[model samples]
Target chain A: MNEVADLMVVLMAMTNLILLGTARLTLGVRLVGAQGALAGAYMFAANAEHPTVHVLALSALIIVAKGLVFPKVLLRTLEKAEARHEMEPYVPYSASILLGMVMLASSVWVSSRLPIAGLTIPPSAVPISIWTMFTGLFLVVARRAALTQVFGYLVLENGIYVFGAAIAGEMPFLVEMGALLDVFVAVFVMGVAVFHISREFEHMDTDRLSVLRD
Target chain B: MTMYEYSCLPVVFGLTLAPFFLGIINRTKAKVAGRQGQPLLQAYFDLWKLLHKGAVYSRTTTGIFILGPVVGLAAIVAVLGLTPFAGCPPLFSFIGDLILFAGLLGVMRFATMIAALDTGSSFEGMGASREAWFSSLAEPVLWLSFAVLARLTGQFSLGAIQSEIGSALWAASAPELALTALSLFAVFLAENARIPVDDPNTHLELTMIHEVMVLDHSGPDFAFIQYAAALKHWVLASLLAGVIAPVHTGHAWIDITAALLTMAGIAVATGLVESVMARLRLTRVPQLLVGAGALGVMAFIVDIMR
Candidate 1:
């Protein structure tokens, strides 16, 4: 069981590296969806010994909200914005990938230093989740596309959920449901904001969105 | 599988099989383009024809012009002697012989570049400059790959390193091995002047890297250069094969055969790549080479972590 979870965590890290190197906004969104799906699978696999009805229900909700709904909204945002590729990135794609490896190494080092007690999953799980969250923030900060930033936010949420699932076997059902609803509403609002920005500016490069600063 | 320490096998195998790789690649490319390709023995025939022809020299050139092909051919053949095939050891091995192998390749490149400059032809000079620049970036990637293997196997010589990476190492550190193989593949493609980095068939001298430097040579000199080019490709492919597909059948002869087949498969793969993808922009070539360096670095990191 631990072996299966370890494989999933490694795969999620690989997907994060791919996301950092990818140039197409659409492909990045799809990879994020796949990562979300893997996170849901991790939840199911980690609680294999005793999967309660609430745990199963929460996993389903995660898969639907993260793997399906968020990506669809982002893809529609991409279509409406007419932005297929990310241009004028803050850093080169290759450099971002190297940076991601660096981030992964640092996360591993940091995870080793901070010992966790009563951990349900592998000790590496927390680091993997932290690394995924760091990668998401990197995408949000480095990419110029607004849709990519939204995808990054979703990845950040997925990492938080992974941490929650690994440490606390099951959160309260109402709290989990509330968290899911909040994510959906946040993505919904972000999608609308992206639609309006594209309509007003005729392009989706958020790097140039600082004209009103003066 | 038992390791056999031997000599003379790589020399005999290299001389016989090097030209066949070129033939296989050309035929594969031709068949892919819907043309009736030349026979698999076409490269052998071309080498024969060139060997018998009279040589020509320009009045502006010096003795180094004649010395280039000879030195290049000897260096390549020497590198071949230093490489191990299958599970058998190389004809020669030393504690730091891998470094010597790299140095010999550098000498070959230096010989060719100086010879190109000796012609006083601006076009050859341009090719030489490009070759020097790209190789400066590529050489480190090659060494970094060697460093990873050396660190993993705890051996500095090529023969020992190749012999050390048995099934146990593969099972233990598969990711690092895969990364090293990828880095070596990139180095092989760049070093051989293959498509994506260079187009051997492109007649436009302005775009040529390896071929342009030899434009002034003809007859026997040209033949030496051509043979040396094939041998260099063979040697590099052998090195790559040793990493990516190390065959250990417990018999030296069978292992040698498996290694040879693996190299032929690589030739076919290269032809397929050429058929599907266009050459990268010259400016983008460094990025690809640097990506290879990145793979080497990642492999080193993975090895350390393991």
Candidate 2:
């Protein structure tokens, strides 16, 4: 179970890099969804010794919220916004990949320096969580599109959830359910925001959204 | 088998096998486009026919134009001697020969560039400048990759570095190995003037880099340029192959066979890239090459971490 969880950590890091390098917003969203599902699997793998019904239920909620609900909302937002591609990204794809690697390495270094004795999860879990969080933040800052920023938010949420799973044996079911609801509502609102942005601007470029300020 | 026996094989086999890559690439492109291509021996036949014909020179050009193909071909052959195939050590090895091998490519490019400049044609001059600029960016990537490999193998010679990268090094640092290989692959594509950099088939002078530079050469001179280009392609491809698929079956014969097969695979892969990808805008070429340099740096970083 530890080996599988360790492998899952590496797999999540790979998906993060893939998200960083891809120029298509749709592909990025899809890769984030895959990362979310892998995180859900990681939750179970990390908590194999202390499995409970609450743990199972929370993992399921995470998978539904992150893996299915978030991606569907973002993909629809992409469709409605008519912005399938991320054109003229703030950072180019290749450089983003290099930056992503640097971030991953730094995250691992930062996690290593942290006091992680309280978490019974594998040593790799801490690094993976921190790296995912860093990548999510990078996505939000480095991308120019609003929909991709929403994905960045979702990925950020997934990272926190992984860290929570690694530290806590079982999260309370009500808190898990409420967190999922909050995410769903946030994405719903963001999706609507994207539509409105598209309707007003005819394109989903947030860089041009400065026209709204005056 | 002994090291002496292995050393001479790559030189003989490389010269014989280099031109066939052009044929394979053409056939693969043809197959993808659903056309019946020329025979696999077409590149060889073209070279044969060209060598039999008389040389033609531009009236304005000096002797530098004649020396370009000769120097370029000699440099490539020297590079071939320095490079390892499969797990076999090269015929020549010296400390810091890796840098010398890279310098040989620079020499070849210099010769080509001077030859192009000597033609005194605007198009050739433009091509020469572009080549010089792109190659300047590409050299960093090549060196960075070498740096990573040198760190991993603790060897500075190209032969030593390549021959030492066996399954153990791969097992220990697969990600670093992969990053370096990818970096080198990008350098290979750009250096060889393949698609996404320069389209080999494009007749448009403005769209060419390497081809435009050689536009004045004809007959035997052109033949030398063609064969040298093919050999250059083979050397770069073999460097990549040596990294990505360092299959050492212990038996020298099997290792040599694996190397040959991998070269064929690289040729096909190049064809597929040409068929699927559109060439980038001329301005985007530097970004692509710089990205390759970034990959190499990342590989070096990864190796350091390991």
Candidate 3:
């Protein structure tokens, strides 16, 4: 079980790098899907013996919502908005990947001193979650398109959910439900926002959205 | 005179005292701008009157319009519980809370922005867009800054950072503190809708950032909106002050006094900035945050080298 957890941890780290390196907005969504899937597998591996119905339900929801639904929603959004590729980035992919690797290594190095052995599912899970979050942030900062940022948002939220899992508490169902509802509404809202962006500017570049001034 | 044991006290106090802080900020801004501003308790009166009045809903507004302020207040309360004020630790503290604190603020931003768009007004949508854009930049700066603090202090918890930092618990130096303090201060002001980054006193919606988003909210909802905004500033300012204040209160009265003075000093500082400067163009706000991000980078470098 611990070895399975370690494997999940490595996959988690690779997903973080892919999320950092990918410039395709559609691919960005898919990486977020992979992240969510990895997080679910991690949670399952953390405790295989006492997996309850609620755990199964939550993981299933993570699979459907994050892996399948979120990507589909984002793809349809990018499709409707007609943003085909991330044309140019503020930070190039190679640099982002390198920077991301540095961030992950630093997180691991920093977290190594912590007593994560007692606190979390796996000690590496701490840094992995942080790296996952940083990759999301890196993507959001580097990408140009509005849809890519939404993908980044999904990735950021996925990292957070994984962090929550590494801890022991069974999160209140209502809070989890509230979080899911918030994500659904946020995706819907982002859909409307993307349409508005394309409609207003006839292009979905977020840079053009900077018209409002002081 | 005693602080409540529940995590809710800081929240209730934070929420209750929010209007007064706004009043103070307005008064200072008014004096600095050379107008006799509204009374120190003017926001309180506004809240009272607004609470008694009937609400007039816009025809095009959706359920989110009604939902915005309620969730807004809820979000502020949520964030307050995540913080510690004066000598009191948070009612609850846990790992990764620093990130969770940012997440809660994002929730507030998310709720308020959605509500702004729900009104179906282009002006409100404009505010929503600007809010989302700037805050997206500001959030990472916030997380990274906190992460720096965490890395230095070796504590993953929010309330634990200061006690660890203050006791000379960590060997980190003042220059690193300088970078952390300044960048976060910038993000704080930007987050609070203050001057240079944003002018809270700006009258027109086009020229406004945070205020314009809540233009449609009226009555009690508007009161909640105002209080929530004030509470947010208070919370952020408190966090900023926490890094600098000696934090050894010696007594509750001293702690309260120090806390109040710190809050007022921040208000004055904000006022001075407004008095001395002009709002940056919208395009420039990101650079300001990025400038702050650069400061974080500098801090990370400085701390790592140390």
Q: Backbone clashes per model, in order?
A: 0, 0, 0
How does residue B289 of candidate 3 score in lDDT? 74
Give one digit per residue, the lDDT tens place, for model 1 in B1-306. 235444567777889999999998998898899988999999889989999999899999999999999999999888988988776788888999999999999999998999999999999999999999889988999999999999999999998899888788887676678778888988988999998899999999899898899999999999999999999889988888888888776877788888888998999988888888888778767767777776787667555543
Docking class of 1: acceptable
| lDDT-sorted candidate list, best first | 2, 1, 3
TM-score of chain A of 1: 0.94
Q: Chain A TM-score per candidate?
A: 0.94, 0.93, 0.90
TM-score of 3: 0.58
* Candidate 3 chain A worst ten-residue window by lDDT: A115-124
Q: Can you write out model 3's per-residue Cα lDDT over A103-214, one digit (the tens) per residue?
A: 8667777666666566636555667777677777877787777887787787778777777777644687778778887987898799789878887787777876687575
Which segments of candidate 1 are over 4 A away from where they belong? A1-18, A33-76, A116-131, A154-192, B1-6
lDDT of 2: 0.84
Question: Candidate 1 versus the native: TM-score?
Answer: 0.85
Candidate with maximal TM-score: 2
TM-score of 2: 0.87
How do all models score by TM-score? Answer: 0.85, 0.87, 0.58
Tell me which residue pairs clash in candidate 2: none
Interface RMSD of each: 3.6, 4.4, 11.2
**Which portions of model 3 show Cα errors greater than 4 Å?**
A1-214, B1-9, B167-172
